[model samples]
Structure formats: C-alpha cells, structure tokens
Target chain A: MTTAKRDTYTPETLLTVAVRIFNERGYDGTSMEHLSRAAGISKSSIYHHVAGKEELLRRAVSRALDALFAILDEPDAGRGRAVERVEYVTRRTVGVLMAELPYVTLLLRVRGNTTTERWALERRREFDQRVADLLKAAAAEGDLRADVDTRLATRLLFGMVNSLVEWYRPQPGGGYEGEQVAEAVVRMAFDGLRSGG
Target chain B: MTTAKRDTYTPETLLTVAVRIFNERGYDGTSMEHLSRAAGISKSSIYHHVAGKEELLRRAVSRALDALFAILDEPDAGRGRAVERVEYVTRRTVGVLMAELPYVTLLLRVRGNTTTERWALERRREFDQRVADLLKAAAAEGDLRADVDTRLATRLLFGMVNSLVEWYRPQPGGGYEGEQVAEAVVRMAFDGLRSGG
Candidate 1:
C-alpha cells in the first residue's frame, strides 16, 4: 500500500512467504502470481529477489538437503560403532527436521514435477542411501536386526522420523520438547516398543 | 477409437483413471477437462459417471477409509490382549495400506482444501484416535513401555506403518510378498529394529 511497506521486501522474507504458500497449495499448483499475491509484493519485485518460483523451490529444498547431509559429516556421525553412528545421525536428523520443519516439509513433498523437484528427489535419495548403508553396517556388526531388509528398515526409520512433519507442532511454552521427541524416537527405534526390553 | 471402446467406461474403471490423475496432479490442480482427457472420454461422458472431480475424490478417499476402518473391526484387532491387539491392528493396517496404496496415498496427502478433503481428514483423525486408544490400553496393561507418551508412540507406530505407501511397490512374482512385508512391519514395530530382543 505504501512505499515504506514495499521497501521492506527482502529475499529471505519473500522465501518464507513462498515456502508457506508452496506447502499450503502445493508446489506444482502455485504460480508466480500466487506468490506475488501472498508475499504482498509485485511480480517484478519478486524477480529482483529470485528468478522465479522454481528458484525459490531450489533454495528451499537445498536448505533441507544441506542440513540433512551435514549430519553425516559430524564427528559423532563419523566415529563410534556403526550402530552408534547411525543412532547419532538419527537423533541429529530429528533435530534438523524440527528446526527447519517447513523447508524439510516442502522438500519431502516434492513429487518431481519439475527439474528442481527432480533434483530434490535425487538428493533425497542420496541421503537415504547414505543412511541405509549405515544401517547395513550396523546389521553386519550384529547391532541392527538382520531379519528385516536393510533398505526397508531404513525407509521405515525415516518414515517414522519424517512423519513428524505431518503432526509435530512446536510448542515453546509447554508440551514435549524436541529433545524428548528425539529421545523417544531413539528408544522406540533401538530398544523396541514392547515392555521388558 | 471404436464405439465399443468408448462404451467400456464403467464408473469403476473411470474412478481408477480419476484417482491416478488426482494423485499425479493434485486434487486442487485437476479439472474436469483433465479428467475427461485422462479417461479417454468426452466431458459429458465423465459427467454421466459422476457429478464432478469432487465425487471422484470422495469415492477414492472413501474406499481408503472403509478399508482402514474395517481393520479395527476384525477379530484379531478386537479379541486379543491389548498389546497383541495393537500389534494385530498395526499388521493389518500395513496390509490394507499396501492393498489400497494409491487411494491411501491420496487420503494421506489430502490438505483439506475442499469439502470432500475436509471430510476425509476428519475421518482420518477418527481412525487415528481408535488406534491411539488401542495403544493406550496396551500401555495401561503394562505391555507397552510406560516411559514414552502413548499418543506419541501411537503416531510413531502408524508413522512407521503409513510410511509403507511412500515406497512399497508390490512385486507379484519375485519380490517380497504382502505377508512378508506385513511380517517385517510387525517385527520392526513390536520388537524394535535391534539385533536381539
């Protein structure tokens, strides 16, 4: 409405708006017009920040992928028994997912409808393969159960971890802390869910 | 195309086509024109099968919901010890999810943008609550671990179970059978993924 309001637009602020709309209406369904309307900026101004909707998508998924891949390079993720390293990765992943919920949420929901989406999917698969190899190593070391297929187990583990995006809402004032959740995931995953384990 | 080919469009077959399109292009992104094209029929012909795209959505989600709700009523889900009953429901949930993969995928992905989607979401929450109650009963009976929140455990359990839709392609001839996948899910959820009990 005013010059001052229009002057406030930045790439970071615009991206936050874009990611929210992308998650709400879906990446394929959203248009530059939709992002313009949601961000309260003109389409030309948006182009000043990023080339187009796809670039915004690329930035968003890259944030998620970077955080995820960074977990693998951490010292804890690199050292210790294969199972402990895998567990360390799992715990840190839950942290990254919660800390960057919206970005990771968008990353997971990309269906490969565009070039950017396909890239996200490929990077995601690379991350999963890395974790699966860790699970296989843990299995070989007699830490993870050998009865279940490694790839399948890896999918299920991440499935449980990723399902957080579907239902986990951060409550800063009260309710389960993220640490509590990470611990719960570790326990249910490593120790089993049944009593007397 | 021959008149005979055009005449072969049953409501059932048309739904198969509609759901595939809906899953491909999201429900909001799809149109009657798209459905007509995908179904290989005229717009009027598609109208004759159902009222509109919403009807197709409703039918597809209802199929998934009915299958899932039916699991709760099975003898194994009802008659066993609380923990055993919870495990039975979990295993059967995996089976139904695999059996109705596309429909369930659509159901899980619904964002409640339309009346039909909202109804689907409400029904889904009700289904989740029923399973949560089973987990609570198991915890109350001292069969499930008490330290973790029952609700969180329920979500994680179904998270693991529902993740099947993300990456469980059925292979009729050589790959894992439905029963084997079901057994794997049960083993993972009940006993945990550790090497030894």
Candidate 2:
C-alpha cells in the first residue's frame, strides 16, 4: 500500500476516507486492513485515532443522525405552521443530505445486522415519525390535501428528499447549489407536477 | 444448518431466500455458505438451482429491470401525450416496485463491487434515462412545470417511487393494496401537497 504522505491523519480526515470505503465496499465488507490500505497508514496508526471499524461506523452514522435530528430543532422547523414546518424540514433535510452526502449515504444503507446499525435504524424511524407528526398535523389543520394518507405522504415526501443521496453530485463551477436543489424539491413536492392545472 | 426442508426447492423459491439474505448481509458480504445456512440446504443444492451467488444477483436484478423496462413498452406509455405518459409510467412503476419489492430492493442496493453489480448499475441507468426522456418530453410540451429542472424532477419522481422499498410493508387483511399505494404516489407526485391552490 502507498504510505507516502503521513503528516495529517485526524479522526475526521480518517473518517472521510473510511466513509467512502464503507459506502464502496460496504460496512460489513470493509475491514481495518482496507482502511489502512486506503488511508495509506498502518493499521496500528488507525487504531491510535479510533477504537476500531465499529467506532468508525458509529461515528459516521452519528454524524448523519445528528445532522438529521438537528434539522428538527431548527427555528423554522419548530416555529412554522405545520405545513410550512413540513416544507422547512423537507428543504433543510435536503441541505443536510447534500452537505453530508457520504456520511448520510452510509447511514441510509445500514441493514441492522449489528447493534450500531439497529440503533441507527431505530433513530431513523424516530426521525421519520417526528416528521410524520408534522404531516399529520398539517393534514388535520387543512393545510395538506385530505385525499392522501398522512403516513404514506410523509414517507413519499422524505423519500424524494432521501433519494438525493443516489444521484446528487455537487457541481464544481457553481452550476447547481444546495438551495437551488432544495427549492426544486419543495416546489415539486407541494405543487402538482402538471403545469397550470 | 437445519436441512429439514429439502424437498420443495426451486430456483424461484431459492431466490426468495437468497434475496433476503443479500439484503441483510449485502451482496459483497454474503457468500454461498450464507445462502446455504439461510436456506437450510447444502451449497451443492444451491449450485444446482443457480450457478452461484452472482447468478442469483443477475436473476434478481433481471427480474426488476425486466419489470421496469416493460413499463416503457406499455400502450399508455407509448401512445399517450407526454405528460399523461409520464403519469402512466409513474403509476405503473410504483406497481412494478411493489409487485417485485424484494427483487427491486436488491437491484437498487447493488454497489458495483463486482461485474454483475456494474452490469446491474448500467442497466439501472438505462431505465432511469428512458423515464427521464419521457419527463423531458413532458416538459417540452409545457405539461410539467417550467421552474424545476426536468432531470431533477425525474429523479425526485422516481425517488419517491424507489423509496417504496424502504418502508412499504404489504398489509395482510386487505389493507393498503399495491393499487392504493400506486394511487397515493401518483397523487402526491402530481398534486401539490398544500390544499387547493
């Protein structure tokens, strides 16, 4: 393995590399050796920064979960009418997913085979339920359409948002900004796709 | 492993078990031994049904890809106006997703670690592009809103459709059938979530 540059290897930096590998090889398929090889550092050196692979998985998922849960606490998320609050959460959640793309990608792919994954899945459900409550309230307040089920609506809305991880790639020369993507998402989710209907 | 139920194994039956394990352990992490253990059959029996693990992956993804591609050839998809055709594809795509849930779910999660995965990814891209073409045509006809980018809208639309694999569990007692889920998806995607404009 190429171990030429070894001056800067913090937990965060190591995490950036680890998350990429985790997404590529998968969390279960990845190992310390893979990390060491990819990081260009010895396994012992990697151990100095974090406990082991599970810690890396935990940290990566925690970062994603923290960002997602934090959106619920934002001022707009908390202060708005239920419908607006749902929109706010939807937009901000897109922002978080784009900003923390790799970490969140890893987060979404967890299959709950391990304790950490189970915890992540549970926390994810909690987040979904919290957002579902906003949708439910919005429906009750006559803000949202009455025809669609609130629970199903909530999943589909976030499904659109969460689907960002699959195809979104940040443009290098400022082609598509996060706010622009967020705007499109909010518009499409709220407005029917048909024009001038 | 318990090998009690060996009399009723078919390629289709074995695929159901293998896909579940593939989803749980992931494609790269899972091995023939895992399949054997999960299916309560020897590795030899698994080989008899399918060539190996990659064959199973190919079969599962082919089932999904076939269903998706078949949507493009439907009379509504080809004959209707672009906007209606888009809606037609969207509604039918959701049905295909629900009908072939596990197969499509496995298809979506492949990460291109192996040749089979790379092929699956390429085929998936082809499917996405075909749907995207319909979206572009709809936008050209001024049916879809002009504000949102057509490509982004396509992704978001299918994003909603694809997200079905995450949380949709079929109800046993005639609750929330596939058609109901498909209807809700079409409504949510086309109509703005907010009450009447």
TM-score per candidate: 0.93, 0.89
Residue B49 in candidate 1 has what lDDT? 82
- Span of 10 residues, lowest total lDDT, candidate 1 chain A: A1-10
**What tens digits encode model 1's per-residue C-alpha lDDT throughout B1-197?**
31224646888999999889988877887899888877778889888888988999999999999999999888888997888998898888888998999999999989887899999999999999998898889888898877868888888888888888888888869666888788877777778888765
Docking quality tier of model 2: medium
Residue A100 error, candidate 2, Å: 1.3
Q: Score candidate 1 by lDDT.
A: 0.88
CAPRI quality band, candidate 1: medium
Clashing pairs in 1: none
Per-residue accuracy of model 2 over B22-73 as CA lDDT, tens digit each: 9987787789999999988888988888889999999999999999999999
RMSD (Cα, Å) of model 1: 2.2
